[model samples]
Target chain A: MLVRFWGTRGSIPKAMRAEVVRSKVIAALVAADGRRFDSETAVARFVDEELEMPVAGTYGGATSCVEVDGGEGDFLVCDMGSGFREFGIDAARRMAEGHSKTFNIFMSHMHWDHIMGFPFFGPSFDPEVKIRFFGGHDDLEEALRRQQEEISFPVPFEWLKANIEFNKVVPGETVEVGGYQVSTVKQYHSHDSYGYRFEAGGKSLVYSTDSEHKDDDPESEDMFVEFFRDADLVIFDTMYSLLDAWTIKQDWGHSSNVVAVDLCSRAGAHRVAMFHHEPIHDDADIHRVHTETIRYEELIGRNSRLEVLCAYDGMEVAL
Target chain B: MELKQETRERALIVAPNGVIDHDSAPAFEEQLHKVLKSADDGALSLIIDMKDIEYMSTVGLRVLMRVSKRAREASVDIKVAGMNACMCEIFKISRFDKVMQVFDTVDAALAG
Candidate 1:
């Protein structure tokens, strides 16, 4: 299974501000410190090795879109956040290359940020495409349709030429789609959300975002631990600090990296990816959070083999 | 969570100690409702003294937003005071600061 992140930011989409780019450039220049590079390769090496990741790279600004390639002819996507635009264009290119134009979109919830990219998804307008949306929400169809209403959007939902289907999934029930087995669990979030687990080719991947874990709910925590057990990769929502999540952000429906580390360690997952970054947080803040989460994992001394990676747009992890 | 209420010069001061989270938000909301229920019915002003509050979450923020909206409909003024730097940052990032006035001290909230 190959997992790719199209967007990682939570709440809303944002671009790096001019000042932020300026600061990174300044930091890179300072790190260079009168050293002259003769070629672009040397500059690339300096950016990759000499400067910190936050100073050289970005987590990107797209919101909540992930693609899981299961070696199947069809496409499998999780959430259609603003990042879907890029995915759609890529799919169109693939279609032009004589590939199947079927899309299986697994929605966590119908929050605006999650579905905002659907209207702009180019494939939906292509008559050759077939799109299937799966979710646990009863009002899933209505919610999607409402967003494309004439009052809210210029295009009507009915105007889409693709063959569209809505599948209402019940919690704990596994569905075989293409070559993967997909399962979902109810999550704690405003208006409720669902976490999906995908299994294919003897490899497992879990996509769980916009869900908060409560300390008082030990049973639920244990359930989640079981839900994520022995997965190759677990993409988790780490949108706030432990201090923030536990204190003032309680019931905010988002978990912290601290909780993610503990859960993944207990679940014996191969790797945990910190995801759904806070929009207000800059790359430096995210780097700090990622570092602190790793430190917290070591502090607990649960399992030294558990891997941690911060999810960034355009990053791909294969299992 | 412990709530201490004091009526000072036509302003109702609500002081909540400890963390305001999922488990405690309901109790916090209930306490505020009780105070509002008992207050004289002309025009109301509330000053939330958060000096002793160590933490808060979006659930707690929702309670504040809900209560503030109700207060607004009733022509009441809601102000917050004594938020720690962390709490202030959360409020600012969440944009809750735009909905209510925040002050460093109770006197400042009351005066403003």
Candidate 2:
């Protein structure tokens, strides 16, 4: 299963964000000599100028969408955010191979960012495409319609002419979609959220976003943690930093990179792509967080058996 | 698949081991609840020895969770003994360390 980053930026759009594209960019420039973080200034330079990507600010297009398939034509996605625009285009291309393509999309919640790209999803806009939407909200259709409401946007819900289906799933229930065993659990957030796990092709992927961490109730905690155990990949919420998430954004309906890292480590996930980048973070800042999150994982001894990657726009994973 | 019980002083020792799994979780829980309820009536403490245990699935952990909740509700404390690393890892990952007390040896658990 090959994984690629389509839209890695978080929150908002950014240019010059791909400021420092990869560790090699920093390694070739700052740390070519293979030395550890020597001084505060050196670490600061690496943090600031190291992994910057080509984007403007945190608005590096906060399109959160990812597709997992092995080019065998099985498409499973997690969200319909602005990123879906690009995913839709690629999905259309895949449809070239076969007509009546099947698409399964799991929305974390009714949040705008998670479903903003619904109407524009290429296949959904196409008459030959079939799209199945899954989430834990009862009013799934109304929630989706809110995005295309005349007041919110020029286009109305009736404008989309694609074949679309929606299911209102409850947390802790399991359903099979597109040959994948799909199960969900309730996640803490402003609007109730769902953390879903899909097992197929002898691999598993868990999507947990917009979930706020709470230690007060054991049952809630167990429901969240036990729901995603031993996941092969977990795309999780990382909308804030630790300081902001706990002291300030506490109970604000999002998680920090620290929380995401902890979840990946504790759940023994093989890969963790941090999701829900804060809109305030510029391209450079988001890249910095991504790089620093790796360092922080090492310090916290949570890096074992977990590969950390930032999700990028237009990226595809051959799973 | 069944629960056996004994008593020493105020501590009532309960043992339920042997092929515990998700399928038998309900039985395990019921037996555990019966023992704890019996202890709550008079016994000062409850000790569960899982030495003969071979396996535990999610359902097994569910049983443990129910017992912990039961302990909290009745104020009848529980001590677990003879946990293997695999079981310990599951408990640790679930953050059960903060919720339930665990020990390495039955002697240590009993003494505590």
Candidate 3:
């Protein structure tokens, strides 16, 4: 299976400011010294080899849409954050290339950031397309419809041309969708969120975000460990530092990178992708946190090898 | 988890040796709770000396936080001292340092 990150930011959409862009450019120039590259390939090589990610590129600002490819029949997606607009456009082009017009969407929760891109999603306006939404919330359809009400958006939910179906998934029950066996686990969030585990062929993937793991909750920790056990890649919420998560940001429904590595390591998961980037963190801050999480894993990942990958927009990992 | 307790004129000091982790955090918590419950009216302060602690995880930190809250409700002062570098970093990163007073030595904690 292949997992693709279209948007990785959490809470809200964040765009890079001019000053931030200029700073990156200046940093790159300084790193390059006075050397002038003769070819595009050489410049690409320099950027790839010489400059770090924070200086060379960005960790994008689009909120939480991820696509799971390599499945049969239909397209599968997790969340529909602002990135879904772009995903929808691309899906349209893929359909022109003989791809299926069916979409299977898994919603973690209906917070504004998670569903904001739905209004701009191109496939929703296509009469021939079919969409299926699966989530743990009973009000999944209600939340989507409320967002599209006349006062909030230009288009009404009833006017959407696609045939959309909402299916409520109960925790601990396995359901087959798009040829993958999927299970949901309740998560701790404001209105509650759900984490998903998808198994296909011999590989497994877990999508767990917007969840807080309190220090006092051993039962919750064990439940999450079991949910994440032996997965190929687990997309986790790493939006806060250990200091922030347990202190000022306690009970805020987001977790830290330290907790992510600790939990994933205990589960024996092969790898983890730090998802839901904190909106306030710039590329450098994210990189620093990512580096710290790796070091933390090395410190506590006893008897296990866990690869930590920081999620970025348009990143793809094949398992 | 082995906890050694000493009673001073105005304080009860509990020192835990070995690692405080998932397996031992419960016992560590229970022992601290026991000390708090049995303290005389004269023993108004609680000192946790971490001189011998090898390591601590999130669970152990939680125990300390819970104990601190309990101590506060009982109108007892709580202080931590003698943490090694690793333990200090853990405390700092989790901001447990901000939750309660921390000292370099037990003597300094007692003096304060």
Candidate 4:
């Protein structure tokens, strides 16, 4: 199984501001100093090795949307955030190249940021495509339909040409979808979010976001550890600083990198992809958060092999 | 956990000593709501004095946010006083300072 991140930001979509990009460019130029690159390869090497990650790379601004490839017949995706638009375009390109036009979208919840991309999803307008939506909420269809009302959007949900289906899943019930075993667990959030676990090809991946971990209740903590137990990868919501999450942002339904590291370590998860980045955090801020999380993990003396990854747009992880 | 309640002027003061963490937040919340219920009909404000509070976790903060919302709706003022430097920093970062008034001392809170 392989995981591809189309979008990683949370709350709202944001584009890199011109000033932010200009700062990165200026920083790169200053680091280059008197050096002159003879070719594109040399410049690329400088950016990769000499420049800091924040200056050379980006933790994209798209919200949610991840694709899980289990080598199956249909496309399996999680969340239809703004990133879905880009993923839909790519899927359309694949369909143009003789691939099947089936998409299975597993929703974490119907928050505006998570479902905002559906109307822009290109394949939904295609007559030959089949789109299936899965979630724990029985109001899944109504929520999606309401988002496309005439007042909110130019395209009505009824006008969509694709054959669409909504599947309501109960927590802890495993379902077979495109040869992958998928399960969900209720999470603590304002609107009742869910964390999904997918197992296929001898690997397990858990996508858990928009959930807050108070770490005060032993039973709830144990349940989360069990849900994440021995998974290959755990995609977590690390949207705030530990201090913030524990203090002012309490019950705001977001966790911090420190909590993720602690939880992943306890669960014995092999790897953790820090995800659902706070929209207000800049590239430098995210890089610092990721760096601090790695350092915190090392300090805790967990499994030496446990890996930490900061999820970015277009990043692909193979399991 | 020790909780002390006092009535000062038009404000009801609740002072919690020791850690206001997950284990203690629920009890604290219950006590607070009980006091609020008794003071609901009056035009009294709510003041949380954190002079002896050693630590407060997210669970503790949730209780405050909930109370703050209710206080706003009821036109009741909520003030946090006697927070140590560390607690003050936490409040600022969480933006709780914007939602409620914070004072350096209980006297200052009462005066305000």
Q: Which one is best on TM-score? A: 3
| DockQ, candidate 4, vs. native dimer | 0.06
Q: How close is candidate 4 to the true structure, as a TM-score?
A: 0.76
Candidate order (lDDT): 3, 1, 4, 2
Over A139-255, each residue of candidate 3 has an lDDT whose tens digit, in order, gives: 999999999999999899999999999999999999999899999999999999999999998999999999999877889999999999999999999998776787688899999
* Lowest-sum lDDT 10-residue window in model 4 chain A: A296-305
TM-score against native, each model: 0.75, 0.62, 0.92, 0.76
TM-score of 1: 0.75
Candidate 4 stretches with Cα past 4 Å from truth are B1-112
Q: Which lDDT tens digits does candidate 4 get at residues B33-88?
A: 87776557777888889999976754677788777767777777889999976677
Question: Candidate 2: where are CA atoms >4 Å away?
Answer: A1-5, A8-60, A316-319, B1-112
RMSD of 1: 8.1
DockQ rank order = 3, 4, 1, 2
In DockQ terms, which candidate is top?
Answer: 3
Best by lDDT: 3
Which lDDT values do the candidates have, in the order given?
Answer: 0.87, 0.69, 0.91, 0.86
Residue A152 of model 2, lDDT score: 82
Ranking of candidates on TM-score, top first: 3, 4, 1, 2
lDDT of 2 at A197: 83
Select the stronger candidate by lDDT from 2 and 4: 4
Better of 1 and 2 by DockQ: 1
Tell me the DockQ of each model, to 2 decimals.
0.04, 0.03, 0.41, 0.06
